[model samples]
Target: MAGQTFDLTDDNKILSLRSPKASISGPYKVVFKNIEERWAIVAIDWDGEPRLAIRWFWGNGGNPFSSGNPTWLVIPSSLSNATLNGLPLDFKLYSKLVDFLAGKITGDQIYI
Candidate 1:
């Protein structure tokens, strides 16, 4: 069975993905939780295996995906970007990420 996705709360908060039994494969069930809301879904990683990363992006209605601050995308302050106050989850990009985790893709597919 496929995993589920969790909706992210706290626009600028950092979210971590973790599984105790799974070998961190493609098609993961995500549960977005923080000091606010809770959401879920199924997503995938494109690289070797997905580690804890920050989700940042542009949202609708002139609302930024993150706050007016910089956050790490990869972890331990590896890749940081100044974004809106929220992290926009791009389904298209996520789909590709899933493919990559499934061993069907690689870094050559990441455009942004």
Candidate 2:
């Protein structure tokens, strides 16, 4: 997914995931506590929405996915520190995530 780009002009615009047909739309927040731990709390305003939050832990090497209603998309990886809604996050990883969410890339390409 390298070299691919996405238009995030609208901060409130959301994108959908392919396989499970999950749609992520609205203003969301991402928080990265450390390089090995991170999580995203997303607002669910769509019909049949699966999860409302996303979590990540690098030590386990697990892929991020929706766990429950008002759900959480958990991702396991080490993401650099950056910012989200004035909070810190991994910009690199965040970029990839934007692409993935925009349908410009696949889940496999979400990591650095």
Candidate 3:
């Protein structure tokens, strides 16, 4: 693996992501699907180092910021329905944040 930096930004109706590669090549593609058909591809900022840029839809109109630790991120729409290691996210959180987000429990509630 190589060291890389990734950033997600916004366009008029799509989200833009920029990626760069220092010493890599061959087959390259965006990380997510539905990029061209569902969303418009805008400008790609490659003025700096070896880089990759992509643009995609910004659906339903919601803030994309996160308010938790870096280890955890607010799930994006493109990934909301995606499974992790073959398990749906809802099941993954059921024993933890699911109850909190569903209002079935609170921070003071104990499950153990």
Q: Could you say which candidate leads in TM-score?
A: 2
lDDT (C-alpha, whole model) for all candidates: 0.33, 0.35, 0.27
Q: After superposition, which runs of candidate 1 have C-alpha atoms over 4 Å from their true positions?
A: 1-7, 10-15, 25-37, 42-91, 94-98, 106-111
- Give me candidate 2's TM-score against the actual structure: 0.30
lDDT tens digits, residue span 70-91, model 2: 2335222222122233444467
How close is every model to the real structure, measured as TM-score? 0.26, 0.30, 0.20
List per-candidate RMSD values in Å. Answer: 14.9, 13.0, 16.7
Sorting all predicted structures by lDDT, with the top scorer first, yields: 2, 1, 3
Model 1, 1-112: lDDT tens per residue?
A: 0111322443222223323213333333332323233222223342445433434322331111225332223332122122111335576655554454445765346333
How are the candidates ranked when ordered by TM-score, highest leading? Answer: 2, 1, 3
The parts of candidate 2 lying over 4 Å away from their true place are 1-52, 55-86
Question: Model 3 shows how many backbone clashes?
Answer: 2
Candidate 3 lDDT over 87-110, as tens digits, reads 333443434433433446543341
Look at candidate 1 and tell me the lDDT of residue 21: 18
lDDT of 1 at 18: 27
- Sum up the clashes in candidate 2: 13
What TM-score does structure 1 among the candidates reach? 0.26
On a 0 to 100 scale, what is the lDDT of residue 54 in model 3? 30
lDDT of 2 at 13: 23
Candidate 3 positional error at 108, Å? 3.8
